[model samples]
Target chain A: MTQLPVRTDRKLGLVIDLDTCVGCHACVISCKGWNTENYGAPLSDQDAYGADPSGTFLNRVHSFEIRPDEGAAQLVHFPKSCLHCEDAPCVTVCPTGASYKRREDGIVLVNEDHCIGCGLCAWACPYGARELDRAAGVMKKCTLCIDRIYNENLLEQDRVPACVRTCPAGARHFGDLGDPDSAVSQLVAERGGIDLMPEQGTRPVNKYLPPRPRDRIGADSPALTAVAETASGFLAWLDRTLDRLPGGGLARMDAPAKEENS
Target chain B: MNPAPSVIIFTTLSGAGFGLLVWLGLGLPGVTGLTAFGFFAIAYLLAVGGLLASTFHLGRPERAIRAFTQWRTSWLSREGWTSVIALILMAGYGAGLVFLGTRWTALGLAGAAMSVAVVFTTSMIYAQLRTVPRWNMALTPVMFLTLSLTGGALLAGQMAAAKALLLLSGIVQIAYWKLGDRALAGSGTTLATATGLGAPRAVRAFEPPHTGTNYLLEEFVHVVGRRHALKLRAIALTLAVVLPLVLLMLGAGHLVAALAALCHLAGVAVSRWLFFAQAEHVVGFYYGKR
Candidate 1:
């Protein structure tokens, strides 16, 4: 049962665009809301509203500061969940057959009933995707909203993962990555999506589109000089007014005032 | 990696127990009736007691029986199966020698081989984890098997084998530490690779995903101080191998052998603690903990 399928029928997964994520954490909150109420067990929190609060969150947003060789440093909001790897190490490491990857959809899930919470699956995961819920004493992870994605009760548009449905920036996209023609697959192809730690050889189903090259601001950039040189209309009048009021224009303030010097 | 006391006790005690079983199974200290009972008693106490101690860390120990089901792919499951089978085999062999006053050579040999298999399977539990580069090496099993054999020989009072194995295990232990130090770097898993942010661009964890530590951090991101680990390694080598080797060389008397066994167990426990505490899980790279 812990052995991986030769190939998943659908490879349903998320493609997160780092270029557009705003780090709002709406997806994180929505995932917590939906999974806690609907999943096998509620994601438990210890020391809630206390000095040291920690909880089991299926999805988490990590913000990183990345600096390119030539450009200004930028913050990339990295929202991570289970990647549902083709060769999911967590699945094979499970002694109880509790952790498994679905052949039908390739969604890695935990059978909460069988989980002894020895945490070997968590240890096997390089991504830190699985969290052992303190109160429930079972390993909790992103199920990719297994209930919501297939539910007939929800509206057709709402039948996606809680995180994907709730993402304000639309940074998250869900589709059949196994199909090269699928939207997520096309996104990966067009944007040159990359795998996290390909060296680990988990063969993650989900992909990340690296942040686009940022607009660089050099010391002599025209954008910088334009603002200094082209003070037009109201700005020109304000400069003249300031020139009349002070010993000289605002630029002259750097030097000794003419009146004081005299 | 958290070096949970339950796990340390489980591995160390069971390792020594199984090691002793290896020697006993080979009929190295062949005894029958009351004398066999004395040897078997210590073996069962260490092996069974260690197995029992392991259950203390489980979140739902009642469901632990289900862990025996998935042996096809899981090293942990295989470990469960192998340990149980080896213990049962050893029990049968012990009963034959103690109660029936018979050697049961075939049963003894099978149990000895199975006991070694149990130790190998146990080593693979950690050795199979690619996320922990330190444990994911061929040297890991070498370290485990040698240490187990060394401890077993020490307990069995096989003076010649104990001395040789102690020297080998000491060398293997040092080599493991030296090689394990370079494993993470050699694996080429950096903050860059972890985030899919390629090299040349400086990538740093500006803020953590959470304000407080979670299971991943608490479980995997143990940062043993370099000096502290060095100190423990020296102590481990001295106690586990050096002292026991010296004591045995001077004399393998009952008292000396007993003291050597105690020193070996303590040393192995400290070494096992370091084995876990110093294992840098690759997930720590994501949190900038590496």
Candidate 2:
């Protein structure tokens, strides 16, 4: 089971648009809530109410503040889980016949019954996707909601992953990335969705849509050039420009508040 | 990565055990029925104890038997299987050496092969970790093999062989650490590359995904203090390699050799702690550690 199959029929994955993501923990919660009771062992929480609360989670959202030189600072929210790579290091590092990638859809998973929870699989993963359940003594991870997606017990519309289904901003898209005609593939092609850490050679199934570049300031908006050359000079014009300014000057960064270059 | 005590003990102790068994199997001189009994007893106790210690690292020790299954890709699996082969062969060879005064050459050779093979695979377990660039060196296996052979020679009281192998292992260990430290320092990853911030710019974490520690933070993000690491490395080298070489140079008997072997192991243990402690996992980049 450690040896990966030469090929998989379809690569099922998720595409998350960083531009639209609201830095919400909904997807993380939904994944924990469902997987805690769904497919495998419950994701255990140690010291949930005590001083140090820690637990296993299949999904996480990392937020970063990136200050590009030309534009306003952008807050990039990254939602990460398993990439379910074709050449998964997590799968190969498993000493037990537990971690395996599905040949049908390329979903990397652990067989709780067979897992020894040695943590080698977790260590092997570059993405930190694999999480160990302390209570159950087994490794758990994003199953791509295999139980929900393929289950005949649910409606076809609700067959998508719990994270995708519960995303309020519609930032998460689930589909067959392998199929060229699939909607997710087309979205990836159009929006230039990129793989996280492609150098790792994980060939992660998930793709992240980069945040949209903010458009240059419009003509109607008062330009920084309109401000007077000196701080005292700007005090005279500040009253006039105050009405036209968005959300008042207090909420904004006044360019002319400081001394200007001679 | 945390230098779990169980793993550090397992790798070094079993490595020495197997190394000594290799010397015994290779038909070392002055190995009589009494000596053979002592060698086998020491080898099995250390090997079996180390293997048992590894089970404690597992979340479920009862299911450790399954670890012997997947040998095709998992170096850990290969280590388990190789240990079995080495132990079984040693048991058989020990029986022969004990009951009959004569040794089985073929069985001894096969047992020795398995013995060295286990240590090799054990090194591969760390060497193969692409996540830890410092560990993924060809030197890793060589280090393990040399250390095993050196320990074996020391335990068998082969003063000359132990001296030579100890020196070789010392040079190799220093070389490995030197190159490994450079490799870690020059690793290509950064917060920009990790988060796909694109265009070289300083990326800072505005807020962590969570307030409290998660499994990833606990397991993957071990930032060793630079001063502490330097001090430990000095101690490790002095104890593990330099001390052993100097002691063996005295050309003394089993008493001196035994003390040297003990010192070598202590040094190796300290070095092993640095091995795990200093390793920077790629996941650390995600946490903005590097």
**CAPRI quality of model 2:** medium
Clashing pairs in 1: none
Q: What digit string (tens of lDDT, one per residue) describes model 1 on residues A102-166?
A: 99999999999999989999999999999999898899999999999999999999999999998
lDDT of 2 at A82: 93
User: Comparing to the true complex, what docking class would candidate 1 get?
Assistant: medium
Name the 10 consecutive residues with the lowest summed lDDT in model 2 chain B. B184-193
Error of 1 at B84 (Å): 1.4
Give TM-scores for every candidate, taking all chains together and pairing residue i with residue i: 0.92, 0.91
Query: How many clashes in each candidate?
Result: 0, 0
TM-score of chain A of 2: 0.83
lDDT of 1 by residue, B1-290 (tens): 79899999999999999999999999989888998888888887888888889888888888999999999999889988888988899899999998988888998999999989988988999999999999999999999999999888988878889899999999999999999999988888889999987672499888888889888888998885434999999999999999998898888589999999999999999999999999999988778886
The TM-score between candidate 2 and the true structure equals: 0.91
Pairs with steric clashes in candidate 2: none
